[model samples]
Target chain A: MPHIDRRIGFMGSGQMAEALAKGLINRGVVTPNQICCTDPVQARKDLFRSFGASSYDTTLEVVHNADVLFVAVKPQYVGAVLTEARPHLTPRHVVVSIAAGITVDMLLDAAGPEAHVVRVMPNTPCLVGETAAAMCVGGKATPEDAELVSTLFSAVGRIYQLDEKLLAAVTGLSGSGPAFVFLMIEALADGGVRAGLPRDVAQALAAQTVLGSAKMVLETGKHPGALKDMVTSPGGTTIAGVHELEMGGVRAAFMSAVVAATNRANELSRMG
Target chain B: MPHIDRRIGFMGSGQMAEALAKGLINRGVVTPNQICCTDPVQARKDLFRSFGASSYDTTLEVVHNADVLFVAVKPQYVGAVLTEARPHLTPRHVVVSIAAGITVDMLLDAAGPEAHVVRVMPNTPCLVGETAAAMCVGGKATPEDAELVSTLFSAVGRIYQLDEKLLAAVTGLSGSGPAFVFLMIEALADGGVRAGLPRDVAQALAAQTVLGSAKMVLETGKHPGALKDMVTSPGGTTIAGVHELEMGGVRAAFMSAVVAATNRANELSRMG
Candidate 1:
């Protein structure tokens, strides 16, 4: 894919906004000088400025200055931000929203049906060049618009295209899944501590184990169950531990967590 | 800091031994010519030889030819293998054992007390250049000997030095933790499937989520809880899913899995 050479801007200079901007800039996908943003918060604006990007005070100002505008505000504020910027958004602009629970229909509704809109649910791992982002095109979004947005996010990590309806499920799996993993790492470290290992070493080992195992799945293109079976010998320590994980219903809980979160995402959309 | 310059050999040409050898050669840290192994299995010997390394029928031939030898036999066969090769193992050779549940004392006792030995617990991710391995030096092993083994294994993945007693915990957490992580990914993928995503996309997202989250924990130098908080907005989707996870005692189950595996590792050692 080609680099996103057009000017880009963000409506909110928050964590997600900064992550996207930083990832794009660091990967040389979009130059820092080609990026700009607006935020009420001084700290966030200052952080944006540090990346060699200019800052504005209002969403309309950012939309006017850039060709590709990103609305990185919270879900509730997405409506107001996009609606306000809708007036300034020209046909040249592609508006991408990273707000949680905000749908493509919502973006199209808020920012005029004529506006090119993309709804994205990107996780925090963008800070580490490993984000798993999902994007959905709106009524007016062109193939070029979708490609531009996907290219922008891919600099941070992998990007998947899905139906807007599946965005909530994406939220549940990739967005919320990280927290579940963090909790698991914490528990694994605690388990190591219980087994007489020092806290730091245990934590390091736990985090790396997850990272490595995940890499095995992604790189090898093998089934997780097959990988798990390979690790579990006829009567080995991994199998013993696996037995406990199975008994504890770890799988069911994760499945339910996603279901509950997806349900909540649907509710938030309905509340809007 | 330097790569292992000596000829290395593996007693068992199994999956792990091949993973290490392949990782080292692929990384260009050690040439395939520097690695040799002996296994009764003809297929295993052919695979090892395909790497441009020599293979032998007897462990004694490998022990005599290589300066740094790895004993990759099963836990139960570690004593017999080492005892059989002990007489041929000259003072110039440093023996590294990756046999689970076999301690330094057992290696020292089985192979003469003067034999230089190091016990390592390495996981399957070594095949992916992201393995989390732990090594403990034996009484007769010198600092140089420890460095050689560590350098050799580091080519395949990261290695940490710890006391011998903690290897069992390492076995529980990292050694067995990959299997637990695979289960989590499977569950997380199932969650996505339940939410209406295609299986392949869901699995990719689940695995990448874990990988990206782990990278954030490792690279950001922030606590996982703090990182989780960074992603969780007030009244957001992530927190809702997290609540369900907490209610499910998912963390406790993972902790218990590690502890159960650690206890099993200790038990296996005791059984020996």
Candidate 2:
């Protein structure tokens, strides 16, 4: 894909905004002069400036200065941010919201009917160009707008397009999934540490194992079970590990976690 | 570190052996001529040939032709294979064994007193240049021999040097940890499918999330909890998902899973 060089604006200067901005700059997808950010908090503006991007004091100013508007404020403040920036949202602009729990319909409703809005749920790893992000097109978003959003996200990591209804599950699995994985890695490292490996060595081993295994799934396109069976000899150590995971009901716990997050997303959508 | 090419000899042509050989060749760390694998099974020998490596008819021929010998046979037959190869083994040759539940002492005894033997536990992802492998030096192996083993393993992924006692835990965590992670990814992908995302898309998302998150911990050098906190905004979608994970005891279940694997590894070590 060609470099996008989009004139992008963010309504918040939080981690998500910074991550996106950094991804854009790192990938040469967007120039510093082409990006503008605003946050009510002065500290956030300072953070934005550290990326060599322009910063404004208010959302309206950011929206007025860019062709693409990213509504990256907290979900609780989305309504106010949208209302404040509404005047600056012109017909040529595409509005994308990274606000968690904010639905496409809500984004459309707040940003105006004609706004080409899209809702994206991106995980924390976006800061490192390895994020798993899912996008849902708003009622008014064109295929072009969706493609543009995807191009921007591709600079960070893989991007998925799904119906708005599935965004919550994305929020649960990928957005929140990192924490679960981190905890697992930490626990595994602790197990290694307990087994008498140095802390750094154990941590690195545990982490590299996770990274390599995930890559196996993606690169091979094999069923996880089939790929797993390949690793596990009959009565080997892998089967022993699988036996423990089965005994502990790991599958059920993760299932429940995703379901709970999806249900909460629905609740937040309804509240809006 | 200088690029050290290891002349690896595999005493079996099974999946794990072939995977390791392919891993070495794929990374250009070992040339096709440098690797000699032996298997009585004709089909397995053919499979090894297709991977651009030479195959021999007997363990003696392979052990005689190589600097490092890997005993990759099933644990039940490892003693027989080691006995067959012991006559060709010399003090200059480093014998490494990947047979699960086999001990360094067992391997050393089979290869004889003068032989430099090492015990390694490697996962299946090694086939893709991302294996997590743990190695423990035996009584006769020198630091130079250990460094050579590390060099060979670096082609696949991260290699750790640990006391022989911890090989079982390494076996449990990484040797079997891939299956545990595969199950988690599969379960999460199913949850995404349940929430209306297509199967392939959901699988990709779940797999990539696991991969990216693991990379974050390895590269960022921060505590997993710190990275988790960075991603999660208060009461946001991630926090909502995290709450569900906590409620479902995801952390506890995962911890127990690792503990179960580690304990099982310890048990297997005792059996050996």
Candidate 3:
């Protein structure tokens, strides 16, 4: 495979597509004009245009023009979109699918036997330049093809490469982890509001607290239990909270949530 | 009263005291030697020496030498430490207590009738450049006293002023919130490990995902739920994880945890 200047296209102009485009452009990985997207919906097309990226009405145009095509449609529609766009794809074109629960095998089948395919699971933070994504290659995708896809994801945030089999677990963890965290922050903030703090003050406190504590774990590299012990004294308030969480089965609940999502992803793969 | 350069003392030689001392010295708010601390433990004295600050053998020496004293002792010994140091305190000195669950009333009473006091609850992230701290002033503290204490905390991280009644809730939320988040990240990383990703790779993804998503919430000012919906389509994998959380009562459990901590803080205040 020869190294070529990166030309990327989005088969769908949804939030994920726009976020990746925004991240790539902001990081100087690709220019606004160099990236192209197509969406049947007028609002989505207009939204993409506002970011100064080129937008098309049909998937054929994007597949015909770009070197790397990101199939960003929903998981259920991935088959239809890939089948429709496959004839325009050649061996030189690297196809990456961002639809969750859709496996690399299904994507490769839809894009034809000769097409190089990479499967990616990226979370919501990519829109704001803080995405955690995992990418894996299958079929005709060479090392060069994998590197190209990795570069695109890395421009937005951290990227990891794993066997395609574990991408669903990544889907369960990072891909859906943000929502679980958001809910946690909301519940904490609501506690503050109920305790008589003003809404904005409460929200800021709740959010910044989460932000700061997370940075602690990254910077210190200490065990979470040690840090928890630092904050908690014998018979102190924090221990009270921990006791409640334990009693309420918070940890088991989160674990089960991730497992459930992973099982669902596997089911989707089998269905496809 | 004339404005004088205040000499501040930290009574414990630990991460929190060192972090605050460094922050104050970095900002020229106080000098290394101008701040005094005491830890009966030799290891803690060495840690203070590493920061180029003076460490004392007894709490009385620290209280006698400094105009503003931070009682950074652990929660269990706050009473004993304050009792030992109280006789040396003068009306000119201010006592700032960072021991969580130790009330301002208890601190003032322990330090005697003339001592001006304040209570603060801060999380461990203060070691970095970010911390969420909530503070409340004692009956004797003036606005100027409050401002000075606020300035000291600001050097370490953000500081918020609230009624003393709400301090326990702040303790429940941010002061303990980090541990809850750390558990979530650990569980998520464990899921990745179970799915065949390397431990280090899984840890990095889990940690970075948290960092980025938190940045999004802080920067965007959008409702977390709204941001969540933006990432999730009608039947996507994110919604699948969300469904499990809903099923397992994640929101309710976390909310109850905060309330439990608040109640415990209130109980601690009455423990004498």
Each model's interface RMSD (Å)?
A: 0.8, 1.9, 1.7
Candidate 3 regions with alpha-carbon error over 4 angstroms: A1-8, A25-67, A76-93, A190-203, B1-11, B21-69, B75-95, B109-117, B139-158, B189-217, B224-236
Candidate No. with top lDDT = 1
Q: What is the C-alpha lDDT of each candidate?
A: 0.88, 0.80, 0.80
Q: Rank the candidates by TM-score, best first.
A: 1, 2, 3
Tell me model 1's lDDT, rounded to 2 decimals. 0.88
Off by over 4 Å in 2: A25-66, A77-91, A190-202, A232-236, B26-28, B31-33, B41-52, B58-61, B193-196, B236-252, B269-272
Each candidate's DockQ: 0.77, 0.52, 0.48
Expressed as tens digits, the lDDT of each residue in B138-173 for candidate 1 is 858899888877788888778899998899999999
- Residues A1-272 of candidate 1 have per-residue lDDT tens digits of 35667999989888788888888888888889999999989989999898799998877778878999888887789889988887777889998888877777788888999999988888878888898889999868899999888888888989899988898899888988888888888888899999899998898899999999999999999999999998897777899999988898889889998888888888888887
- Give the poorly placed runs of model 1, Cα more than 4 Å off: A42-46, A54-61, B42-61
TM-score of predicted chain A against the true chain A, for each candidate:
0.96, 0.93, 0.90
TM-scores, in order shown? 0.92, 0.87, 0.79
Candidate 3 at B131: error in angstroms? 2.7
Instruction: For residues B30-65, write the lDDT of model 2, one tens digit per residue.
Output: 778788888878998888787777888877888788
Using TM-score as the measure, which candidate wins? 1
Error of 2 at B237 (Å): 4.5
In model 3 chain B, where is the ten-residue run with the lowest total lDDT? B1-10
